[model samples]
Target: MSSTTRRRFQHPAALIGAAVLAASITACGSSDTTSATSPATSAPAPASASAAAGVLTVRDPWVKAADKGMTAAFATIVNDGDTDVTITGVSTDVSRAEIHEMAMADGKMTMRQKQGGVVVAARSQVALEPGGDHLMLMDLTRPVRAGDQLDVTLTFADGRTQTFTTVAKPFTGAQESYAPGHGASPAS
Candidate 1:
């Protein structure tokens, strides 16, 4: 572990989404119910500029817990430096990591692979939301349920691995409510 300890993060998205889901968390960082997620983890802990002598801020981390073979993760990668941070991979206690993207095809909702990568601009942030982008948790070794705290370590392009803590929450919207780009459809 780096000399820097973990500190409280208040990212823009976390501040905004916290109001909506804060009540859903049962305990301090545990979710009140099972939610939806991406594949497995993010990537393979790649080298990143985000990596510093301090702890990287990964906020709003959420994943779903079903008996299914798939899951997703969402969070904000905040860099406390001036270099552009590229998140190469993500990891969890469940399974390996892979980058995924949700796309609507011919009236059918599907999530596929993201070949390139997800980038967090220098001195900026990146958010993983429902309709936008996220990390996929695949081939779960076990079922992640409510009240579970997911330990995710993100790798940057600079050979730095930053571990973050994410609290699970019940996915608020309907199963088919149409998120915009991902699975959410029937836009009204």
Candidate 2:
């Protein structure tokens, strides 16, 4: 083969190899980064709020701030033991906390304050969703941002009380789930 011809073939071959090497390096870097950060970026599982030694496990707790300085939080409560638990009362920095429900009435959503409070069956779970049953943080002193947490106290029907902090999130039009005895009980 002529020297010039050999030179042309070598240059093109080297260019192609460099291109392949660059593509491979980019692909490897992206995969490593995604794998390294995937777990941390994924949603958190759940956290628990304990009673006077009472355990209340909470999942995906989310709160929506209202323009009138009120906010609502919805979540699932799990009783991880044999004994049933009751959440009778709630308190927050906002105006008094209460169990409230958003229901459809006359083609409009209406909010009703609940007085019966919530009960988690023994070894069972209760979900507090939007539109049906949820927590009302009245007269919020501060805005509940996406990454913020709200500290609340929950009282039981047996006069046993438990306080815990809950993470706040924006509501996504989820219907609130209802359980018997789930509402804001009369404050003592």
Among these predictions, the greatest TM-score belongs to: 1
lDDT of each: 0.57, 0.60
List the candidate 1 regions with Cα displacement exceeding 4 Å: 1-55, 103-109, 172-188
CA RMSD of each candidate after superposition: 12.0, 18.4
What are the runs in model 2 whose C-alpha is more than 4 Å off? Answer: 1-46, 50-53, 65-68, 103-109, 172-188
Error of 1 at 109 (Å): 5.7
Candidate 2's residue-wise lDDT over 1-188, tens digit each?
A: 99999988998899778666654543243221223212121223224443223467665455664444566776667787788887878777655678876655577666677657888898888877665677777666666665566767778888876665666544434433223233323223
**29-109: candidate 1 lDDT, tens digit per residue:** 422243344323332221222232234545446665544455677766666667667777778888666666667679775
Candidate with top lDDT is 2
- Candidate 1 lDDT: 0.57
